[model samples]
Target: MKRSERLVDFTNYLLNHPRKLTTLSFFSERYKAAKSSISEDLVIIKRIFDETEVGTVETFAGVSGGVVFTPAISDKNSQEIASEIAALMGESNRILPGGYIYLSDILGSPKNLDKIGKIIAHEYVGKQIDAIMTIATKGIPIAQAVSSILDVPFVIVRRDPKVTEGATLNVNYMSGSSSKVENMTLSKRSLAPGQRVLIVDDFMKGGGTLNGMKSLVHEFDCLLAGVAVFAEGPFKGERLISDYKSILKIDSIDVEKRSIDVTLGNIYTEEK
Candidate 1:
């Protein structure tokens, strides 16, 4: 292949496998090029990646070394995206009867999820995340988004039991939104012991559900890598989770007036 063709192919290959290492010999053999040539191509690719803020390609030295592609977005880009999302989410027409904001459209959009996933994945980059865990309904999209970017499997925590999943481990906890006790179940075989799990959810009011997920993680003997909520709404009382990160924060919701105060959450301030 010509050098131009090889560069395009090499860049595509690395883009497909974020945070994965591919040896120099493997690339050299695959491209039918010399080690020196492959190294030179990587330098060009790495420069493009850094300049674009798309991601970074780190080349390690040694027998066990190769190159690993890490996905990243600049703080400025992240803040811009978050600000746009906050404005879009604050529309009064999206308010439900009970002061809840409608976010299905945003969550369901592939374009939106793509940006959301990239933003969330960027935060957890370099962390030892084994799997992404989320509840069955709304959280699935966000979990899938993050997992896809991180190149990891996502596990769903269900409110109801399904026989198809075989045995399940169920945990009971308070539902922060409804203020009612609820049970969440996860497949016993879905996760292995000692895995580092990142819990993600679409919306959080008081974090009751997220807390339950944390308990479930302990039940499976897995470590809690982190917790992330797409958006957090103001709760009546104290929130159960304080350490979790949120993409957007709903400061106030006035049902009568149908107004929402939305702002970029702590992730932008903390990370950026």
Candidate 2:
């Protein structure tokens, strides 16, 4: 293949397989090019990736060495995306009957989900994240997006158990929004002991559900990598959890007036 064709194919492969190691030999053999040529191509690809703020290409040395692509978005891009989402969420028409904001449209959009995933995945880059965990329903799309970018598996935590999942582990916790006790279940096979799990959710009010997921993580003998949410609403009482990241913060929702105050969340302010 021509150098131009090889560069395009090489860049595509790295982007698709983020965080996965591809040895120089593999690329050399695949492209029918010398290892030296492959190394030179990687230098060009890495420079472009850096300049574009898409991600980073990490190359290692020696016989066992290889290259891995780690996906990331620049802070400027992350801020722009988060700000746009917050603005969209602030529209009066998005408010529901009970002061809840409608986010199905944003979450369902592939374009939006891809951006959201990139922002979230960028935060966890270089961290040891085994899997992305989220509740059933709304959070699935967000988790799936992040999982794809991180090249990891995502597991769903459901309110109701499914027979198809076989044996499950259950945890009961207070509902953040409803203020009632609720049960959440996860398949025992979803996570293994000592795995580092990141908890993700579409929305968080009182953080009770997130707390429950934290407990489930402990139950599985796994470590809590971190918590991330699409948006967080104001809670009347003290929140159950404090250390968490959110893309957007719903400052206030005036149901009667149909107005919402949306702003960027801690995702930007938090230490990198």
Prediction RMSDs, each to the true structure:
1.2, 1.0
| Model 1 superposed RMSD (Cα) | 1.2
Window of ten residues with lowest summed lDDT in model 2: 263-272
| Residue-level lDDT tens digits of model 2 in 96-182 | 887877889999999999999999898888899999999999999999999999989999999999998899999999987788999
TM-score against native, each model: 0.97, 0.98
Clash list (residue pairs), candidate 1: none
User: In model 2, which regions exceed 4 Å deviation?
Assistant: none
Q: Write the per-residue lDDT of candidate 1 for residues 1-272, one digit (tens) a residue.
A: 77899999998999999889889999989989998899899999999999999898999989999999988888788888889899999999999997878999999999889789988988887889999999989999999999988999999999998988899999999877777999999999989999999999999888999999999999999999999989988888888788899999999999898899998888976743
